[model samples]
Target: MTNFKPGEVTTTHIHSDILNRNITLSVYLPEDYSDLYKSKVVFCFDGRDFLRFGQIHRVYERLRREKAVERVIIVGFHYESVEKRRIEFHPQGEKASQTVQAVAREIMPWIDQTFPTYKVGNARVLLGDSLAGSIALLTTLSYPRVMSQVGLLSPHYDHVVESLFQRCQFKDDLTIWHVIGKEEKDFKLPTSGERADFLTPNRTLNRLISATSATYFYEELDGGHNWKTWKKELPALLKYFLSNQ
Candidate 1:
């Protein structure tokens, strides 16, 4: 139904030594892309799935045409596979943090060199869903100056809440936009009754963000955990992040 033009989608690849994996990166440049203006960049995890399931390209095209937001460079970082995604994206262990660091240190610099980006302070943003959300949040905390804004949509909250608040350093330089579906189900542990609930932990994280003088926006949408919900929320998220421009 949707006809997308050529040059609207650009693809690249990054090899990370930290994870010992090759990551395929997909970038969507706005129609007016030129060397004249440095576009804002938004790095998103679960790259392949976001394209196939979320139809993000169409959404971006419509929003940009309507002037709902400024021009942006959407960088989609693809993981190895769905099975390995949990281990890679969950911010629960040391390896997860290592992978996040690799992305920040290695992959991002490569992108900057390859593309015409606005490498200015607070111009870059990180976005993800579910476990990828945990990775994005942790990565932002780890490199607050580099990753200034984050869009967390329906994150899985288990070990991340305590780990993020207790271990990471928060500064006023960051702006986090957190959104969770109210109807999203909570995961149950085999031995322990139930792990940390999603909504409450996100609220607690919000409170922590508020106390740290960081710009924060928390929203609870009436929906469930799926791409459909995320697709519905993407426009508003784009507006909020691009409002300053």
Candidate 2:
């Protein structure tokens, strides 16, 4: 098959046995994608916002045009609704475990079948923001052999997630790019209207990751838990992870 365009996008839907629903994944091939390259694949949660609000395609295009770093294939998981997202992404939600199972059993296998994956345990990345980020954290910890890097953009951290981090074994190759806003110490969730202190919990998570042998980069950036900060920092996030710099 001839390469589509430098930044072409296509999509696929597959049924998730664990969630008992069909899920959509938007796939974006990088500027120079070819069989000769060992493709790094980034599986992002909260993908709608990552593409819309985060404008990752635009940023990724610029990175490629400028020849800033090595590029990766972007595969984004699109949630059906905000309510359903809560069910899947939240640590305490009804379908939380189901979401992880779906990714491990359904999504990851599908990715390997369809894409030119570099490696299962090294070049694969699992990432997201807020509650989505929390799911990334849980999934990575649960299946350390599946992914190497965890990209967390102001994730919603709680006691259960903290306990998991404290108890789980980290692969020596594990890397985390965690960015939490200092203002997230107290705030209301966008959809649920629930009050949460993300900063404090993320700080605790930072400490937990610090105790592990994993390569981790945790930072308290200037903005709160919103898309603005995430969008602005996304290029740096991509470069940091993709370039290993």
Candidate 3:
């Protein structure tokens, strides 16, 4: 088991000409990031909490030092407020479309121009938790050429977006790593102020993905919808998908 500690997080601002908004980006790089080595780039949503509660930077550093995962850059986009988080992370929200466009058109191009990144789609990854997980999947499906791999930690599914599952057609190139807690069936949603059945929709999603030929992995743990469970599983997902490939 890895005992991970928090590492220093650096911040930068990028102006998205498409949305006419400037987004703050928090980044973590491996210790030897200055060397002439190309590294995979990971974009994470719901970032501040992930760094605070998930300890993802430390996990990354430890994994790299132990040679358990590949060298990589972790870029996090923090939600300004809870309301903004729900608004932007919602797959049907207008902000979600803008966020996806910013990722595909502006943010990725900036990373490619500024960092020593493996620019191929297969080398890029999108990661998110809960509703942000839904954002990650929607974004990857929207721009499969830019992000081919996704890590979804308990993605929220609503009745409005069932068509996405029926429309999924990226089995040929996209890969997915997903995990949901068995206890998420009666999870309370803050945004909707209603008890949601996350597990059922996630199971439906699992079945849908299984029907496709995409490389996929799914795990149902005896836990709840929280960071503790995700933190525990993060290292393995990183090693399996992003290491040595």
Query: Which residue pairs show collisions in model 2?
Result: none
Clashing pairs in 1: none
Model 2 Cα lDDT, one tens digit per residue, 1-245: 32335467767788887898999888888767875666778888988778879888778778777777575888889989988998899998899989988988888888787676765676788889999999998888888888768999998888878777766675576889999998898888777698888898888888888877899898899988899888889888888777733
Model 2: how far residue 33 lies from native, Å: 2.1
TM-score per prediction, in order, is 0.87, 0.92, 0.92
lDDT of 1 by residue, 100-149 (tens): 88878898897687667888547888888888888887788788778878
**Candidate 3 residue pairs in backbone clash:** none
lDDT of 3 by residue, 1-245 (tens): 21212245777788888767778788876676764888888889887777788988888888888777887888888887778877788887768878888889999888888778889889998999998899888888888777989999999776545576556566578889999999988977766678878888899889878888878999998888898788998898788677764
- Evaluate all candidate structures by whole-model CA lDDT and list the values in order: 0.75, 0.83, 0.82
Which segments of candidate 3 are over 4 A away from where they belong?
Answer: 1-7, 159-161, 190-193
Error of 1 at 86 (Å): 1.2
Candidate that would win on lDDT: 2
Point out where model 1 deviates above 4 Å: 1-7, 159-161, 185-197
Show model 2 residue runs off by greater than 4 Å: 1-6
Q: How close is candidate 3 to the true structure, as a TM-score?
A: 0.92
